[model samples]
Target: MNIVVRDTLEAAEAAHVAVKQAAGLAAEEAALPFKQARLRAEEAMRNNLTQAKVLATRVGRLKQQALEMARESQAAQRQNSTTDAHRMQDSARELMKEAQELESQAKGFQRMAEATRGGLGIYALRAKAAATRAAQRVNPGGDGPLLLPPPPPPLRPAPRGSAK
Candidate 1:
């Protein structure tokens, strides 16, 4: 009888260990998909951040070019080259519009990056601030006073030559 009771106790202990091991394996299997999803999300966030940086750089260049063209247009107008001034003004307007669009795109990317970053990590905060600054620089006045110069006067048709 003693021998049978000892064997039964040992068997119960073995069964307990086997159950625990099976539970652990099941937990890990259940978590596999979640882990994979997290990794994919992180990769996507990294790609978005890289693209945002590129866009911000492009916006900066476009803003600078637009400002320079605006200055040139003002100079041409001051020099009384009406046709040249009008041309430069049109070019500057187009450049500024493009810059504005790019700036908006950058802002959207930044928002997504921030949301993915999660928590209050210093690096994430700094990146968000930098993105905001870049957008501000691109747009400048932002519905307030106009940064670019006013449009040039409308073009006038040249007078017809008098018939000989």
Candidate 2:
């Protein structure tokens, strides 16, 4: 498990570097859908962080399921049901593979959470500082997801009046 996580993290870091190299070109060619690029990137990072959390949760659940299957396989083996044991073992292997993939996805999201600087570097730093301050507040916890509220929408300008 450590090896798997270490390998995935290494791969994601490499991906992060690659993405950074291309980010300037990507940002330039892409239309500025919104006027507030830093706000958008902050929002994007928060969302990616949320996804990473969700993926990690999924991986954890999958690992538990795989463990359950292993336990059942052991029970089957004890009962002399070789066929059932084989089937359960195979299912456990599949579950482990799924967990590994989801773990890698989580790592990727974690790596990308802060990768959207591009031209928004200065603004992004300020936004991150603000967000760090905001995160200090007690996060609501329980059954519900703990997502950060998105930055407020950019203020629109007042309508122009007719020239005198």
Candidate 3:
């Protein structure tokens, strides 16, 4: 009877240990999805940051080109070369367009980063803001003044009456 009781107690202790281990395994299994989701969010945030940096660099280069074009346009104008001035203005406009596109892409990445978890969103936003501030410094007035073409000359009233 003593040996049988000892065997029963040992069995119970074994069962208890198994149960505890199973419970721990169950808890880990349940947390797996959350862990995976967190990792995915972190990865996405990293990707967005990478894209934002690329766009920022592109914008910086475009801004530099625009500044150079503007200077060239000014020099042309000063030299009384209206045609060269117009061509340089067109080139500057193209540079501005490219820069604006890159800025937009960077902003999109910033928004994606903001949608993610783990403070990555904040960093993304800050990067975008810094890029914008830099662009603004290069292009004061948000895009500089519009350089619209002059309107057509008005028709003479006498010519209109004769045509009628």
Worst 10 residues of 2 by lDDT: 137-146
lDDT of 2 by residue, 60-135 (tens): 9999999999999999999999999999999999999999999999999988885754445767455554443333
Give the top-scoring candidate (TM-score): 3
Scanning candidate 3 in windows of ten residues, the lowest lDDT window is 155-164
lDDT of each: 0.68, 0.68, 0.70
Ten residues in a row with the worst lDDT in model 1? 155-164
* TM-scores, all models, native as reference: 0.65, 0.52, 0.68
What TM-score quantifies how close candidate 3 is to the native fold?
0.68
Q: Which candidate number maximizes lDDT?
A: 3
Ranking of models by TM-score: 3, 1, 2
Name the better of 1 and 2 by TM-score. 1
Q: Per-residue lDDT tens digits of candidate 1, residues 130-159?
A: 544544444343323323332234422223
lDDT of 3 by residue, 62-142 (tens): 999999999999999999999999999999999999999999999999888877855545544554555455544443434
